[model samples]
Target: MPLRDLLLGLFVIAIWALNIIVIKVGVEELPPLLITTIRFMLVAALLVPFYPVARAQLPFLLLLSVTFGSLHFALLFIGLEHAEAGTGALLVQMGTPFATLLAVVFFKERLGPKRIVGLLLSFAGIAVIAGGPTLPSPLPLTILLLSALGWAISQLLIKRGPPIAPLALAGWVALFAVPQVALGSWLFESGQWQAIKQASWVGWGAIIYTAVMSSIVAYGIWYTLLRRHPINRVIPMTLLTPVFAVGLGALLMGDSLGIHKLIGGGLVVSGIALIVIKFRRAPRLA
Candidate 1:
């Protein structure tokens, strides 16, 4: 990456890093699923107007919508409701290794010793997190990890499918996700209307920030950088997200990170470093 694009990539990473904190605030005011539904709805409203559909990719596109946009965000928001923003950021990077493992299993991709070590370090970090005092409970961590797995599966699908325009696909994914997420919210989450009606500016602002900044603007910048540079060069910049997440959570939200978090977060970042450094990388979570 050139200095300019590298700086642009860093800009996107900063936006994404702060997005976890935004989601944490949003979930506090609205039902998690309902908030997800609204976020996608807002994204769809903005993007579908300009992007044309790729009819050939509809099936896979819908799959991406459900797995990446719907299930990923739904579980993520729910997990964040119980978990801190900083911890959610660290744990979600597990998706890269999860996707690598899935590739080994289903696509016959090879994982060398270093990647295996990375996997162990990553999971061990999660275990340490489970043992730590920061999280509300083990259940929220499990939900967050499951969300990571869903993200991995989505990346696998995208890897297998033929190429499509990133923005068009993103718009379609948001459009398709609205219904799936809205249906899930309608079925499992209550007070959707009340939450929307009663929500303050902070709640609505968080939704707009996530929908516009996190999803549309950040992804647009990311795809632009990917086009301008090698994937490996651009990918490593994402590691900063957790760093920003942990820092912002501590500074703004007063979320405590004890010694265990430092140890565990270090292990997770080290593992991710190993994976991105030595091997084929996965597409990042949106």
Candidate 2:
């Protein structure tokens, strides 16, 4: 890969990694659901203008929106309200492992021994993280895990659904997500009116970062790179996202890293690496 593209890829990862922090900050200021509602609203307003989905794809698109947009982000932001940003980021990595397992069951896909190990290793790490006696209320952790599963389910829906442009799918998800998320915010959360009225720049900045940088710009660059490069070359770079997030959380947000977290996080990232990166055989000699 060229240095320029490498830097660009890192830039996208940085945007996504920083997004964890932004989300943590945003949830601190405004209700998590409200922040999610606003983010989806902005995303829809911007992308739906340029990218439109086909009528045939609407039903599947709506399902995707429900899982990818509402369930995932709703639970994620809400979970992060009480969890550490770094820890939440680490837990979100479970989405890949969850997706793999769901694929095995739902799509009748096969997993090799290595992937099986990866799956076990990842979940064991989660157990370790949550096993600590000092662990807070299990509610946030459970919500985070469910959020990851929702994301995994969304990926499955995308694969099962009709072929649609990535950004177009994202736009439609954002557009449809607006009502679902807004309704949740209205029903479960209070003080939405006051949150919008009194929020500082951090809260609103989180909205812009998530809607524009994380959703659109980061994904735009990502798919462009995927088209130009091999999946192996591009996909492995994603492993760095959590690494960056952990560091940023500690440095920027002062997220505490307990001993259990250090061990558990290492296992999680290592397991994800095993699951995601294919170890190719050496070239054969004649």
Candidate 3:
């Protein structure tokens, strides 16, 4: 990668890392699913007008809406609402292994010894973290794991489905996902009108940051890099995201990194590193 593009990739990672902190703050003031609904609505509104969609991709978009936009973010934001930003960041790393497993099962891909060890280590790391005191409860961790699985599934779908422009994919998925997420908010959540009325500038700013910077700007740069560069070169750099997220969570949200977190997080990251080090990459989380 050229130096400028490398920096741009790092910039995208930085935006993604900080996004965890923003979502942490946003969920404190608003319902998690509600935040997803609003954030994606803004994302769609921003990008849909700029990109034309093909009718053939419409079915794929609907499926992606469920896996990527709705299930992924709905569970993620909900889990992050009660979980530490850093921990949530770490746990979501499971998406790598989750994707690997899916590929092996569905695509009949073969994993070498390294990947097997990596998978075991990743699960062991989650097990270690499950025993840690950092998490408020098992529920958030469980929810976050589900979110990661949704994300992994989405990756496979995108890889198999007809090719679409990155921004168009983002836009159409968000467009289709809005109603699914909105239904969740409407069903399980209350006082949305009151919450929207009462939310401060901080809450709304967090939403804007997520929709614009994290969703559009960051992804635009990232997809450009992937298109212009080799997958191996661009992929390894993404390992920095969780590391950056953890540090930013400490600095911005005053998240504590306990011994348990250190050990568990290390295992999880190392496991993910082992998985991603050799093989490939993706467009990143939605």
- Candidate with maximal TM-score: 2
Candidate with the larger lDDT of 1 and 2: 2
1-286 in candidate 3: lDDT tens per residue? 6899999999999999999999999999999999999999999999999998888889989999999997788899999998999999988889999999999999999999999999999988888877888775878888999999999999999999998999999999999999999999999999999999999999999999999999899999998899899888898888888889999998988999888888888898888888888754677888
lDDT of each: 0.88, 0.89, 0.91
Candidate 2 lDDT by residue in tens digits, 1-286: 8998899999999999999999999999999989999998898888898987778889888989889998798899998899888889988889999999999998899999999889988988888878753344789888888899999999888888798998998889988999998999899999999989999998899999999999999999999999989898999899889889988999999888788888888888888888999999999999
TM-score of 3: 0.95
Instruction: Give the Å error, residue 227, model 2.
Output: 0.4
Candidate 1, 211: how far from true, in Å? 0.8
Clashes of each: 0, 0, 0
* RMSD (Å) per prediction: 5.0, 1.2, 5.1
Q: Write the residue-wise lDDT of candidate 1 on 84-187 in tens digits.
A: 89999988989998998999999999888898898899888877876788866779888898899999999999888879777787788988998898888899
lDDT of 1 at 113: 88
> What TM-score, computed on C-alpha atoms, does each candidate reach?
0.94, 0.97, 0.95
Report the number of the highest-lDDT candidate.
3
How do the candidates rank by lDDT, highest first? 3, 2, 1
Per-residue lDDT, model 2, residue 37, is 90
